[model samples]
Target: MTHVMACIDNSQSSLAVCDYAAWASQRLNAPLTLLHVLDEEKYPAAADLSGNIGLGSREHLLEELATLDAQRARLALEQGQHMLEKARERTVISGAAFPELKQRHGHLVESLSDLQEDIRLLVIGRVGEDNSRNAHSLGSQIEAVVRTIHRPILITATSYKKPEKVMLAFDGSSTAYKTIQMFAASSLCKDLPIHLVTVGADSVSNHEALGKAQSMLLSAGFLVQAEIRQGEVESALHDYQTEHGIDLLVMGAYGHSRIRQFLVGSTTTTMLRTATMPVLLLR
Candidate 1:
């Protein structure tokens, strides 16, 4: 069965990520998997010992360093195990029935790609444990992971708030249209208030597109609101979300349409750094 896979890490957002994943799993009625990856580069087994040690003490020093490396590797393994267990506990507590837990040692992007086919949605923190220090920076693994996989990703904010309403940042692109259609057919957006927002000049073309989308959802018995606003996409959308109590954002990843293009731009990075709610990115 397809699972809502949560990428659990030692970030400040870890608990919130797990909770969001659990909520999503229950809401969608899908199974859950919590994965923790130990990147070798981040937690190296040994420091480089070449040319630094004096020739006389080299043999003894090398053996000592080897022993230390062994210890470090063991500690890292234990730490990762603990992280996964904690994530599983939190997920189950949040209402996931028997979420699967996994610990992997490798590049995170590669591991995600290997399991991409089995994942229906990917949940991750906007900023990871180490990268959380830089508030404005996106998680180091996010770009690479999104670039590698085509699955929808739910990027959690640092704080967990159960979402009551969802906003779709719509732009006139095949990808955005497809995303709207996909959500319209799924239970993920059903029975909840939806805000379909398009930011830019108010043109006939924009109106036609938004109108069709609103009409489609209304026909499907969705409580949908379609709004058009002017100015920059991020700022306008952010203000609207803040004013309207939007708790979840749904949008495409990248496209000629402005929303996804802006998503790949600096604005989305800024949003990730200071996002107040979860964002569901359609790839």
Candidate 2:
């Protein structure tokens, strides 16, 4: 079975993401592993600093430091447990099995890498409360994990409610086919109607690709429809989703090159900016 790892914090965005993860978990019949990492390196105990301590007070200061570290660790664990419990309650209500909560006292990047052995999908909130609004395209931790891991990542924003009307942006790429196969096999799309849109290099090419994708999805038991549009990928996709009231937008990330993603930018960047719904980005 596929295992989806949900990295959650106590932020408002995380709560909605947890609900969304639960929704996905039930549909995929996948095991949900709820993870929370305690970033003690960033938020260390203030009392542990020993710059002004004299020789006589060294022992007392060291003892106090130990006590403070213990307290901080305890509080972090307690907070993590509470958040996981709340997430579990939402998962049960969403008709999904409760996830196994995991709390690790370390950095998020390290924690995620350590548990990447059996994880199929990594789910995380778009941004946390501590994150700066100026930051673009996910937080530091999210970016680090995505860049490091090869697994598919579903980054959900706070505004995500539920994915009812879904849109698939197909480009006749291998990644696109992998994404489609995943959606077709998952329980998430069983009841969800999909709009298969293929952006055309030319009118004829676009029509052919869109028709092919529609036939494939129809054969897979999806209530699929096709739309062929001529324009820039980001603009065409954004406009189509907006007009159709799409709730979820699924597409392959970084089709051409990693260098292009950074230097020339990509359609994924443009779509992320213009999309009004949650994006399921496949590698």
Q: Give the CA lDDT, 0 to 100, for residue 11 in model 2.
A: 69
Instruction: Output the TM-score of candidate 2.
Output: 0.81
Local distance difference test values of all predictions, in order = 0.83, 0.71
lDDT of 1 by residue, 160-226 (tens): 9998999988887777778777778767768889999998789999999999988878888899999
Clashing pairs in 1: none
Give per-model TM-scores. Answer: 0.92, 0.81
Cα lDDT tens digits, model 2, 58-157, are 7766878778777877887798889888887877787777688888877888888888886777788766656635234445455566566677777786
lDDT, residue 199, model 2: 70
Write down the RMSD of all candidates, one decimal each: 2.3, 4.0
